[model samples]
Target: MENVLSSLIPPHGGKLVYRVLQSAPGKSHLDSLAKIRLDQNKQMDLEQIAVGTYSPIEGFMGEEDFRSVINTMRLADGTVWPLPIVLDVSVETADQLAIGEVVGLSDEQDEVMALLHLEEKFCFDKEETVIKLYGTDSLDHPGVRMIYEMQPVLLGGQVDLIRGRKSETRAYELTPKQLRRLFDDRGWSSVLGFHTRNIPHKGHEFIQLKALEDENCDGLLVQPVVGKKKSGDFKPEYIIKSYEKMIENFYPREMVVLAAFSTFSRYAGPREALFTALCRKNFGCSHFIVGRDHTGVGNYYDPYASHRIFDQFPDLGLKIVKFDEIFYSKKLNQYVQGNSLFPEDENDTLRMISGTQARAMLLRGESPPVWFMRPEISSVVLDSVRSGIQVFEG
Candidate 1:
């Protein structure tokens, strides 16, 4: 069959970025990385670049690209990029390497992961980065706290993945290349991408099904981020299992594809939403769903800020499907758009369960109502909680 994806939107910047090395480096080159190792977060960044998930971003941002992204949400060459993808390093580490030098990137076990061809080593204003990207300087936000805790120096270079890390949730991990191929094989010309860091609630499913119907898309890609998240958030294992159960019991199997992306959440609200949409574009998603408070944390961002961000960027490669806050109408006994009204109610009687409320209910051995979430999903969450799994506390 002809590839249906031939008509799908192309990757951002008109190319899919893949930086994995074609051949292994010599032993002498590997010996140089003996003392330098990257943290888990940086390793995840490298993995994204290698798999073309962060397409159009071949490696860490240079000083020019970093400043451009922070100040104007664009790359140095004027590509629409919302987040700064920089490899941070300590002052001592920066002092050891010179510009144009290549250094090996390794994990905690001293396993060589990638090789960084250094172009520039610069220092960034942490406060500026926090304010620009996250819209807050307060350490109360997890994204802000993470930026404050990063090393003082930033390393900019094109990275070549020497060895890739194995994902714990390997079965659900699909790279951009693989997703594009799958979409082609399935004869899906228009695929809608839905990104989430939380378990599937009724409101989420409602939006997904609504988008699929409204856009008349051929398929839906449910991609969840399976990386380090704040406390009280759902664990990766529970997330995968819950999603698997939800898809099996609820969504049409052939119409939906469940996958996971390995990347840390910055929780930058509007900016993260745009960043996510661009990433999804690289994954061959023609349309992206941007709901209220997408990638938000606490009360830092306005509820509809994510939708507004997309409105501001008109040329974003993928079409954005904006959704208003959806809630379950007790009077109608079904999910309804928040702006819509039920004839039986004079006052707004729409109800929606927040993540905190759902988590608390599950912890207290209460199952969320069918209108809120599937019992199958709740069972997996409750089982994990009972087994003493670490959840995002925030």
Candidate 2:
């Protein structure tokens, strides 16, 4: 249906990166190479890179790009890439690897997912990278813990996909090119992108609608993180189902698109926020919402740190629409943004129920109030619990 490419926004660094193999390789060919099995994070990143979601980054990062990203939030060529996308392998695998050779990148099931054309193999100071990229070397931080637990060696090269992954929510798991063409066919030239991990809350709904209205965008892209998340977070299936309920009943039928972002959370804070902006830009988003504490984990980063970082990088091409902290006001019986306390606002107190709290209530078979969460959405969550579905990641 997409006869022509979307004319909305050009991908970061010019063109979209698609390094997947067009045809399948024979069994004898794949079985001969050394295999490097990928972890959950690397497995997801491989597909995103191949599909152009992580556009302009064809394969994993080499020493130069990896060092440049960790030290200076930019690629080796001075592109505005904020995060590292490198593959890690054990010491034994690293020893057997040779420069300019090819290796099999397989999943945990030993299925060869792609073939990596080995370009660079190197190592760096792990602690320095952890401190610089995550802003702290504390293992208590999830991002820092991930870095410390990684393999000692990093591999950088391009990948040619042999077999692509299928999603649990297959119907809504659309790729960048599909989304771009969908937006173009809808005659929407200005689409806004919103990234989230939690199920819908009143505050989330308010911010989504307000951002769309304020920016005067033509459509909205709601990309819920659907891959690996920290323990106690909403499981991928439940989040997708709850969102499906919201979009079908509540959202404007023709003006919104719901898709699953099949990637793991780095909890990389502001840098990950920039990464989202770049990814969305490739999906034909004209603007992206930088909300309070976007992609933040715990109290490691400042609440408004993401909003401020966008200001320092003005050449991102994607326009950012910043929204302040939002909470529900009991007196007004509505959600309101901002935390500034006025004299009259003293009477209008705030009521906050986090995703964790909501999950606890649902696990107890008690529904959150209508003001906090819609009954329809709660029903989906409660049904998932009642049906013995794994509601939260462990």
Candidate 3:
């Protein structure tokens, strides 16, 4: 039974989608793409689809899929895809392109990214997308703001990655196939995946360790998002270095694997949490740890919304390990879940530190106490801050 459950979950549509051009196109084909350019977000989306990171999605969503996903959180074919990955282009660009035509995707520097085979061009209801996906249409939400800023036109079709380039985080990035092979090679049948965008604190470690033990899993995967994030989030380099130090000196190395996930953060709170879990499921994780305010931003979402959202998707194909908020208990001299503590006098100690406080402390040249964070990890952050490194620069 364990072996059966350990078998990798299939890519959403029962096969891994790789739409990249296997061989170089002719000069004529190349010339066609030179006429149009794609932005960084679309480039990233194409790369993701080509590599099967966003498997089951062969290309950008068509009008049918887009409308269905916005109204029902499923594709037109009834596939349970929560997020719509459509390529938005300006009206002028759309005017120059037509169905059955192909366009070249490029970056700001004129570096070719992909060739989009246009299948459909349509307009989306931005207001509806914001309401359905984010539960609010207010521009105050980053995801909503992004939609409002995008061009009114949407391009739908398959993409042939023509000029894929290795990313700086490539050293830490692992495809689904590679990760599955790693898990098999390590004799790990049940792996718990933990996703994070910020530096890991003691609470984070406590939850990960506890989940590993409670689930009696074979290993833990510390997969951090290393793509475009809000300005105040931890830098990819700092996040990677800190985790390396923490895993080497603190964690049981044999039971843990660290990798980077390159994907943009939508900050859609609960919906984003579900989307992330599906990605991890495709990456061969048998279980995922969902903590308090998982994938949330500011106070837009309920504290336990991420946990509750799991109830709505009973067939997500991945086990969700729900964890309560963890805080330091001075009486116990260790981290404990919020519900485990007994009532005590005002003098009794139970304190929790926010990520904001941790960052502020690091920026102030102060290290979080050993109880709240490992010295090695905090030291790396301190060093980066002292060097005047802009850890959150996009």
Judged by whole-model lDDT over C-alpha atoms, candidate 2 comes out at 0.85
Give lDDT tens digits, candidate 2, residues 1-394.
Answer: 2335556888788887777778878889989989988877788899889988887889998999999988888999999899999898878889999999999999888889999999988987889988888889987998888888888999999988887765576677788888888888898989999888888877778888988998999999999888877777887777777878888999887888888888888879999999989999988898998888889888999989999999889889989988877778889877776755467876777877456668788878788998888999988878877888877787
What TM-score, to 2 decimals, does candidate 2 have? 0.95
Task: Give TM per candidate.
Answer: 0.93, 0.95, 0.93
For 97-139, candidate 1 gives per-residue lDDT tens digits of: 9888888888888888888889999998999889888887898
Candidate with top lDDT is 2
Candidate 1 vs 2: which has more TM-score:
2
- Which residues of candidate 3, in runs, are more than 4 Å off? 1-6, 344-347
> Candidate 1: where are CA atoms >4 Å away?
1-5, 33-35, 342-344, 384-394
Pairs of residues at least 3 apart in sequence or in different chains that clash in candidate 2: none
Task: Give the per-residue lDDT digits (tens) of candidate 3, residues 251-314.
Answer: 9999999998888978689878888887887777889999889988778999899999889878
Give the candidate number with the greatest TM-score: 2
Compute the lDDT of residue 93 as modeled in candidate 1. 85
**Candidate 1 least-lDDT 10 residues:** 1-10
**Which of 1 and 2 is ahead in lDDT?**
2
Worst 10 contiguous positions by lDDT, candidate 2? 1-10
